[model samples]
Target chain A: MMRRILSRPFAPVLALAGLLTSLAVAAPIYNAGGGAPRAVFLELPARLPEPEVALRADPLPSGRWRLTLAARHFRFTDICVLEAEAVPLGHAHIVHDGVKLAAAYAPIVDIGPLPPGRHRIEAVLRAQDHRAILGRGGLIKGAVVIEVPERAGGV
Target chain B: MLRVTSSSLKSGAAALIIFATAPPASGHEAWLLTPSEIEALALTPVPFVFASVAVLGPAAGLALLAAAVALALEGRWATIEERASPWLRGLVPSLGAAVLRVGLAAMLLLAATGGLPRHGTAPWTQSTLLVPDMQLSLAPGWDILIVVQVALALILLLGIGTRLAGGVLVLLSGLGLWVFGAEFLSYAPHFAAPGLMLMVIGGGAWSADALMRHDAPDPLTGPAAEALWRGARILVGAGFVYLAVAYKLTQPTLLIAILDHGDFPRFGMTYDVIALIMTGVEIVCGALLVMGRLVRPVALVILGAISFLAVVLGETPLFHANLYGALFVFALAGARAPGPRPSRAAWRMA
Candidate 1:
């Protein structure tokens, strides 16, 4: 009985073991790095060679203020705009802040033609690989303070 | 009388020990699925569970019925002299039964394969086809290989050449377990349970092997033979179950930190619930399988649960393998064998 049981077969067992070992070795590599390539913006020039700067706002607001500013190689996806707390200033916040929004992958828009007031603007970039943000992608620039004088009859 | 009773008690006890010690579920990781994905696949827990129970439960029940009928007929026909030459009579039915079992197994395999694409991404497709970074070949050719393996399993189940067929099925199942090992291991309880079941119990009395055994001595009669078969089964079953239980007991601790920290990719409430339920089912099924009493019924339930999960949770190859294993066991357990016919002295003792 012992012999019979022992003698039953070994070929299949060995084959299966070999197959399992191969699959085990292969699965992890596929799952870890399977997305799009990573990208980071090192530096952006303040003004592009060609610019009547293209500005667009996402979810056009009849009532709210928000927009994105892009020109040449610098394109922003889903930038948020807020009313400038003071006169002649505009503020922009990056929508997936600190994350490199995958090129057009992050739905950002440009908004403008502002009623001038003090404004703050920020930009961030995220890596395309699993959407990780590069280190300190956030940037704050432009009108920290703006003063628009009351002209003629306008208050 | 006391000896007979004691032996029965001992056998029953051994069966219990074997069942209880059977492995807990371990193997194969399922694809990360969301509630929306499950819904999109039109797989709700209730209907899938019902379909699973319906297919395997009835098959098991019928197999048991057939076993009971065969046992009764064996007893009544024991005295008949050469109704059709003993070899021919035995060989024909054995062949027919083997063919039937193989045919049924084939149909089930086909259905299972056909059902794969409709569900959300299978591990094979995700790992090989969709994910491009890996160097592995999607080997869409392997799908054909899988079909051939199923075909081989059918041939084996049919009992055309009992031992050879069993051996082939075993190989095919093992290869399947390996290729999809990670996936099955993650869902270990579900796949391991059925895989072990089939590995241990070949196509039962309904196969050609049983037909060949028509005139042979009762396998359970000799202590040595019984011990060998019983011990082998118990050791394998216990080993499998122990690993599973240990894994289940430790999974929460291992995964909780990741889940709570939100560091783990694709963690969700539904996946957690499914994992917990599966763990619970594995513990219970492992216990029941080792026990061996009402084995058919317990197996039926386990098979149903697996099938339900397969559909509702999205298709995993392991579930299909498990379903086949359970179905085979149910059929074998149900095959008719003679009840003990009492001798005059035995009757007097009783």
Candidate 2:
């Protein structure tokens, strides 16, 4: 009677058992490849230091210059540049600084070649609404000397 | 009977094992992570491994413990069962069934208030249909659903309208399946045992369904009828587990992902391993449930497996709703009085 009781339920049980055993033994494998590229990582300080700027100058083959500036702790929603000579501050254009090229809110910007010589690059931080100067006034400034290496082989 | 008892003991041991192995909840016991961590994990995808295990482990332990206790005390004379008048013998099952229903409702309520609200808009109150967009709109018809679910829970708990209540619960399960989509998909593999058990078995000896049967002729009183009912339940349970395993096999990445994440510090190695082990255990339990050799033991294992998947996996709200119904059936299965005498004519037909 006990055997009969136990035996009655075997067929379905065995079937399920077989199925589970097969799955466990087979064990699935996943392809680790085929995923997206990593994004650039930036580490910014919680608050920027006061208005300090640094610059590097690269001379292009066309004799135009690219000046990259890094400003420390200057916060702005938008960025703009005014020619050093034209500014109301009466600050003299240091030297051969040219037309303002491009402006950005982040610490980096590129300004170009006037007559290649010593020049002042002024970076101004502006408000989001574009109405006012960011801090006490409109301006933060940095300067770099650009000496285009004279072309060696060119006529 | 010995086999059943041994199986029960084994399940109880398994529960104890899981309970002992699980880590204490994190100091940061917040259900959701901080925004910074969310962003980082989204980019890295490493944290999910630990998080999944941590959530699933304790739930498994609790579920197993519940199953063990249920199995151990099954058919044993308890105050509720003994005091129940012969006429109210059916009430025993009804009360157990009620507990299952009400307890599930209570758990869902707690989860909705405590956890779900933090992540996204409440399903009932949210209007926007898009789940991922974080737009919160109350689900259309949510009020009626909640009201009816709560009412059914109350009726089941009160030992009123066993069959009709069970039927409504079955329907609710279907509705729940529709609304919760992906949220339910994560726990889809674990749905079979309880889903089948409840819908097929109709609350055992302790349910209102059984109580109603007592007053009326119960077809379930017959050995053949009882066997057939159990058989149907077993088949459903087995089929669910089989399908889940088969589906998992097709998606190897999920298994690999689970394994890769196994080393996460918060989830702990022991519990993570156990979670993986449970996948196999469930498949075996489901098979055993269907085979019907050691009905009691197999049922206990399946119950424990379900509990582990639900509680430790932290999927209680999603699956517990169905568990309420399944437990009602389990309670009845465990509560059969030791005789062949038909309690009512209805039982004979069943």
Candidate 2: regions farther than 4 A off: A1-17, A21-155, B1-95, B104-144, B176-219, B222-228, B235-272, B302-321, B324-350
Candidate 2 C-alpha error for residue B284, in Å:
1.5
TM-score between candidate 2 and the true structure? 0.42
Where model 1 places Cα greater than 4 Å from the true spot, the runs are A1-155, B1-32, B35-104, B107-118, B121-151, B157-159, B176-278, B291-297, B300-304, B307-318, B324-350
> Once model 1 is optimally superposed onto the true structure by TM-score, how far is the C-alpha of residue B68 displaced, in angstroms?
30
lDDT of 1 by residue, B89-123 (tens): 23322332343345435533543344223223333
Model 2, global lDDT: 0.38
> Candidate 1 local accuracy as lDDT?
0.33
Tens digit of per-residue lDDT, candidate 1, span A24-128:
222222213221111111122334221112334433334333445553332333322111111112222233222221133233443332343433333323222
Give the lowest summed-lDDT range of ten residues in model 2 chain A: A34-43
Q: Candidate 1 at residue A49, lDDT? A: 29
